[model samples]
Target: MASRLRTGSADMAPPISSGRGPVLWGCALAVLSIALGFGCASTSPARFPSGRALQLNVPYFPQQVGLCGPASLTSVLNYWREETSVEEVARAVYLPQLNGALGIDLTHFAQKKGMQAESYTGSLLDIKDHLARGIPLIAFLNLGGRVFPVGHFVVITGLDEAREEVIVHSGSEANKPIPYQTFIAAWEKTRYWTLQVLPPRPASL
Candidate 1:
């Protein structure tokens, strides 16, 4: 079962549904769980029709501590069939002062490599559109509290309409599932910052 992590400091964490554990409860269930002290129940993840959701076979890289940017970028780049490594990406973009690569730097790095990378949308429909096209996305979020906001980058590998969750590659976790509402809350904190990197365009014939 996934732990009930708190959204305390700057960076992504718990309390929000991880989609791995079934903890969501109706009002009465919440009160009952508290009274019984049994905590939330665990159940199988809700299933969706194939057309409604899907997970791509994107490469996942467990980010080195504090290197979500490089790790996330590597996932998508490799998805496009480009060969790379976390260290290679980090060397190209990581910043020592911030201890993380900046969003702009990530985009620039992709562009320099001849890929079409940019911020496309904050809309869920758009996200689904990209995923349907066999593309993974990089989302920037503030997983921490207001006073100690922690910025984080996660790769969106899939989404399930039935479960309302967005699957991600976060930190050391691969294929971590985050509920849509929970994802939106954290994503909104970062003003819905997201990146999409596509394969380089073919030159005109």
Candidate 2:
């Protein structure tokens, strides 16, 4: 099967878009960057690590234009069994004037859809813990400089200790492997911002 495809439940409804829609298009200045700003990713073949590793099945959506936030969120939402499309996610989160979406908007979108959403400055240990539990996460990376931040969102799926790489659904690729050093260099810019969607709890017996 193609990487982007994933089997899901039949009742998945796209989350309803809400609030003022896009945030105010204020600010006189704007940071310039490429689509999704996945500058840390390279088109090189990943050196599959032989050491400790873990991976989870997550959906993938090729981001159109600067909609990495929507695309990345779609993957995680689907992983939580809340299947949705990038377009549907964009309606709730995309900030056209900025050419991308913000972390706040994405989290709110998930919450409005009745999802258990959380965003924070995540750690490497945190990532491993979540992945071990079969949960994938969304990460915001500043691939630009301190003076000008070129941001992007990618779904993190696994960690390869031997090669020091983190498997992610990035850019136009799914389950792509990026070096830990490279990923962290950009991730640090945003203090390792992470977004997670947890599965609903079981009902009382």
Candidate 3:
């Protein structure tokens, strides 16, 4: 059977014109490298370790137009042992005028729901390590080709070293294996923005 590829939000800006030449591509790559460097510099190596394969039993929530943020959060929260619905999350994270939710909105909403949430920038290796440690991540991906004209949020649930793919719970699909390079390129458009929702720790008394 063909792989089930879930689509993202339709509220993205229009795609870039195809007329741009190699010059634009070169500049974009340079910027991406610099962005990756700056983003990865602050992450501690001890927190993210290399891994071969890692998968977690994360639930799936198919998102409607502009509801990807809430849906992705619902999956992550569910995996963290919280019973949540997309509707409940949407009520807190979704912005009616923008037709979508920002990363900050999602973080704040998660905090209100009693989950510890934080936003950060990291590399693919960092993501792989987090999955290996059983931490599912929510990331902002630029599905817009040529230029980053569109953005979508997804849950990173697993990684396969042999296949060189990252498994994601995207929209309505579970275990979608996106090619490593393909996923990285799209993720780089957003400078590898990630939101981590950690379970609350017991009180230390």
Candidate 4:
């Protein structure tokens, strides 16, 4: 089951307008499990050519601390050829009380905007596979350290098998390379939730 966080009530103040905002704050309802092992999970040699990295030109948007949802969504939508803004997406999916968007909310909003959005849990290979097929995906992560527990969203745009890292557009940081295992650890905190957004399918011939 997906975790939940309560930031007071649905009647809380509306989302802020203007400025890259503060990282979102929320109380997690479930303890995230980080027991997934990464042993023997090296990148597949065949899937990626030796020493060759895959990266896409995903747009970047710096996010206010609590606005990663909208910012990340904006990046993905724009990559799929949709012209949208974080503010517009914030209006559609932002929950002031929760201070962040649920994966389901993001998926719904993308679908409503005529994109093909799907949420699933998969291995790093799956993500690399998507990238190989010219698809980028959104990953839910825990950015907080031992002192703070925070939730974040990022867009995966590339993979470097040589470095065993994945490139992501992370909150104003474009094409940041995170070690594959490190990403898995952070992503595991959110149950490995991933969102795939694709352009609308064409009509049958």
Scored by lDDT, the top model is 4
TM-score of each: 0.74, 0.74, 0.74, 0.74
Per-residue C-alpha lDDT of model 4 across residues 1-205, encoded as one tens digit per residue:
1122111110111222232222322223223333332112122333544456888888898777667878888999998879999999888877776677666678788999988786665456677667877778888787666345578888898988777778998866888999766776676655556678888879899
Per-residue accuracy of model 1 over 32-110 as CA lDDT, tens digit each: 1111111222223333335366899989998876688889999999999888898998898877766676676787888
Where does the lowest 10-residue lDDT sum fall in candidate 4?
5-14
Error of model 2, residue 139, in angstroms: 0.7
TM-score of 2: 0.74
Which residue ranges in model 4 land beyond 4 Å of their true spot?
A: 1-46, 145-148
Off by over 4 Å in 3: 1-51, 145-148
Candidate 1 accuracy as lDDT: 0.67
Clashing residue pairs in candidate 3 (N, C-alpha, C atoms within 3 angstroms): none
List the global CA lDDT of all models.
Answer: 0.67, 0.67, 0.67, 0.68
RMSD of each: 14.2, 13.0, 10.5, 12.6
Model 2: residue 138 alpha-carbon error in angstroms: 0.6
lDDT of 3: 0.67
Give the alpha carbon lDDT tens digit for every residue of 67-174 in model 2: 888888888888788878889988877666787877777877888878878665565656666776677888877777757667788899998776667899888898
lDDT of 3 at 180: 71
Error of 3 at 164 (Å): 0.6
Pairs in clash, predicted candidate 1: 5-14, 5-15, 9-144, 10-149, 10-150, 11-150
